[model samples]
Target: MTKCIRCQVDVADNHLNCPLCGIKLRESIKDTHVSYPEYPQIAKRKKLLVKVWTFVTISIIVFSLAINALTWKVKPIGWSPILSIAVFYIWFLGQDLYQKFNINLVAKTLWNNYLILTVFFLIVDNVTGYGKWSLNFVIPFLGIATGFIMTLWSVKNKSMWRDDIGYILLILGVNVLPFILFLLKAVDVLWPSIASLLYGVMTVVGIFIFSGRRLLYELQKRFHF
Candidate 1:
């Protein structure tokens, strides 16, 4: 004799399903026998990564400010990489703001700021006789803005892990975009062209990687799957 755990009905020895309830008895047996692994260390590692990123961002801002102050009297305004420092500060500030406020509007504001600054710098660089500053300023700013936007979107929707991964990839892609452009222009490298092409590929990939599950769920619900 055996028991149906679901309905507490008596079952025969050779039976797989509960006769009265029609629940699978074998599944209950398998569930009780199987073990799941604990993942506390994995959780700890993720927390550490967040802390390290936070510290690194702060250090970069402080280091950039220190270098700027030390070189203020010696370096030309156009040559001083203040735009680079500004991009870093803005990127981290956007992350902090998202974490604190979980606001889509802030993300949109940052994106707009990035575009405006890029255009403003380009005009200044072209009109006032500064070379390459516009390109230097725009690329990283766009990358950081993209990463921040994805991150904020993820945060607002409670997809923190996927959001963090997307943010990391977006940052990497943004940093690499300028180098790819340079290589294509200066050396005529096909690899840089490929790399630049990959920006679009990776953005789509990141979207799918992070949002695929949610999208699938929504689709299933919408279509009655």
Candidate 2:
């Protein structure tokens, strides 16, 4: 549509001057004009997958609530509470997995396992009317099992709680509670509690032996008092 008089070259990009010669371009005397490509306009739309997923989750929640209400009416034995707790836990776990759930395998493992034990014991307590099994048996064994897992995972990873050994030590401390209950004559089944305490003690001793003074210094820094 234009020509650079100095360079005698045809320019077609709607330039005011020649690209190479920097000379002003002269417009053509043609009746017609050059046309460039034009992009088509598109309408914005919502993400279908997200909308579907949200709708499904809402429907499930509503259905669960209706089931909970009906079950409670037929036999009110804490079934509705357990269902509510389970739903809440499911939502929590989903969010955890969706977000940053990479590191701290030990903590996540313990937390989830404990949730299972908690729900189980809650059901047990409801079914039995009134029982100490949840506290005497479930809590002790689950705590010991959690400690064993944390110890095993820490050994496997080698970098867990190197700076902050408090969590590990706290688990080991809880391992002593069952023995205290035994001494107080609170639990009928003492053997299982004793076994759990032994396992926790052995795990702590193993860590101390293998980790040596590094763990001691870490413990000192963590305890201070």
Candidate 3:
């Protein structure tokens, strides 16, 4: 018998994968194996990132509150920064909940939703209020960049990255397509309300398709029933 590296379960000598855990088993003992310590190291790095992001989120909230308090009399439609802070807080909280509950799919869905909502809110707020800020642009840009980084990390860790890739594409399309339409003055040619409705439908469809696939794969792998 040989041991499954992931679940530590013993498998029959002739088995190619662990029956209980679905972990791939070596055909022969001659295959080089990763050390146990490496698993802990990866976990440690993930924990550290979580801590750092939490700290950054808290700092943003505190700083925003302080600024709002100091400039209460001169508040300039404070929605931009407020929305940015809200986005960061939601992202952080979603990640924490996912880690605590091991609800990876829910966490990913919330993360993607918050990211796209942040961009839409920022653009609408800025355009309607005739205000522009560098940070407004920064939030969405960072969202896409960080999404890509997380996808790459997931791939390296042997986790599911397909859902992430789909999310990144969806966000990119949502954020960029609006600008193209605006440049062409397509809003005058097309009804804004109808366009918005179609966009919402597309976003929901994309999430459903990608998330459904991941759910099916997980159920089959874990229960096979």
Candidate 4:
């Protein structure tokens, strides 16, 4: 067996490449042994858990739709859609936590979930009589929390800072939206928006202050400059 330098995993001589990353391997004497450990029982258990979770959530969504259909005349607020979106968000969250993909992919998944929840609550707010709570409070505060968490995580995992900086910047762009909406009168309460914007600005400033020229290099590389 030969080891893949990148993945640091053993590869059988019969394989021409690393199984995980697909990098070509150095020539070696032919062997028939498995290069990686096999956990058939654990794999089966995970698969069973996934199937059970999917079946349960899908059943709940279907039941909700049926109930909504039957009660359409009495209360037609499309709460079923909200429930469905919540389910989807939960599935994303669970998958991210369980699969533990690379940090960049996890960050993007979270960002996508953020967008999904933004739209989700907006729809909920509109359907529930446009209370403006979603915009005035929920979204802005959510943005602030997301940005703060991303910055904190990136700082904690300094090794992946390059992978996270671009995403953090993207999140900061999202943070700008709350205040912009406030300016356009789309958001009534100013405090949450101001707080989000302030947090976003502070995050960027902190990155610049601490990262120094590395931040510039990362920005340049990300922008292909």
Q: Give lDDT per model, in order.
A: 0.59, 0.68, 0.57, 0.82
RMSD in Å for all candidates: 15.9, 8.2, 16.3, 12.8
Ranking by lDDT: 4, 2, 1, 3
Report RMSD for candidate 2.
8.2
Whole-structure CA lDDT of model 4 = 0.82
Candidate 1 residue-wise lDDT at 26: 71
Model 1, which residues run further than 4 Å from truth?
A: 1-102, 149-153, 156-203, 213-225
Tens digit of per-residue lDDT, candidate 3, span 48-84: 8778777877777677767766887896555446555
Model 3 Cα shift for residue 50 (angstroms): 1.5
The sequence of per-residue lDDT tens digits that candidate 4 reaches over residues 103-168 is 656567668878989989998898789999999999988888777777777778774455777788
The clash number for model 3 is 0
Ranking by TM-score: 4, 2, 3, 1
Instruction: Name the lDDT value of residue 44 in candidate 4.
Output: 76
Model 1 lDDT per residue over 1-225, tens place:
788888887798788888888887775555667668876796677667667777876777677767777887887454334555465556656655544455434444445555556665665676468576556545554655565565556567765443244334445555566666666663233444344446546665775787888656654665588
- In candidate 1, list every pair of residues with a backbone clash: none
Which candidate's TM-score is highest?
Answer: 4
lDDT of 2 by residue, 88-180 (tens): 556556545553366555466465657675776757576667477876688788888787777667767875556225666777777887788
Look at candidate 2 and tell me the lDDT of residue 99: 38
Off by over 4 Å in 3: 1-39, 74-80, 86-111, 114-190, 196-225
Q: Compare candidates 1 and 4 on lDDT and give the better one.
A: 4
**Which model is ahead, 2 or 3, in terms of lDDT?**
2
